[model samples]
Target: MIRQATPADLQTLAQLHSQCFAESWSAQEFARLLAIPGTFALLADTDAGFVLVRVAADEAEILSVGVRPERRQQGLGRALMAAAAERAFGHGAQTLFLEVSANNAPARTLYGALGFAEAGRRKAYYNEGGRKADALTLKARLPLGKSA
Candidate 1:
């Protein structure tokens, strides 16, 4: 089931992100965002595990999302994306945008399958320990009927 996230979920989200991303946001950052106007967060919970996400405005950029590493490729990511899209459209978003690591093939494929198109790229957007990673900017334009 998908539902709005509370501040209590931040710690688990932070830990999940640490396992998924080379660099992760602090719990404090997530807490701060949770209190911001126009920011939206959602989580999917099941017997297996959960996935969490935060988007900004109705036209949101996916701030972060992750499922338990042990549960990867079991479709939780897709579930989270679908939930975010629904929330975004319900809130009057015309388009959803996100920046995925250029090298993350699985995420790119998942986004592409869900109607997201590569709109642009940000070169060397993340630098960690002398290594750099570029970002692929993707967008999914929603039909007018889907918007509030």
Candidate 2:
């Protein structure tokens, strides 16, 4: 089931992140983000997927989204994203943005499928071992009138 994430979910979120990223965020980092005024998170417990977002004014930024490697390709990422967007809109967000490593084809494809468009790019934004990867900025306009 998908649900809003509380501070108590930090360890599980961090564990899921570790399986998805080469450089995973720590539980302390997740705590700090969650403590921020506009930050929010959602989790799909059974699928081990989670999405973190920060909304301010009419804009929302996706901080991170991940599913355990073993649990990927099962639509968990999409479900988490849909939940996050709905929650952000309910919180007054009119648009959403996120940055993904250019090298991450699967994530980029998923975002594109969800109607996110490339907005910009950041050069050498991710440090992968001894290499650097570019980051792609993506944006999606929320259907404000349908928000609940």
Best by TM-score: 2
Give me the runs in candidate 1 sitting further than 4 Å from their true place.
46-58, 143-148
What is the model-wide C-alpha lDDT for candidate 1?
0.72
- State the number of backbone clashes in model 2: 0
lDDT tens string, model 1, 43-128?
A: 66642233433445557677777777788888888888887777777777778888888877888888878888888998998775
Backbone clashes, each candidate: 0, 0
lDDT of each: 0.72, 0.87
RMSD of each: 3.3, 2.7
List TM-score per model, in order.
Answer: 0.83, 0.91
Clashing pairs in 1: none
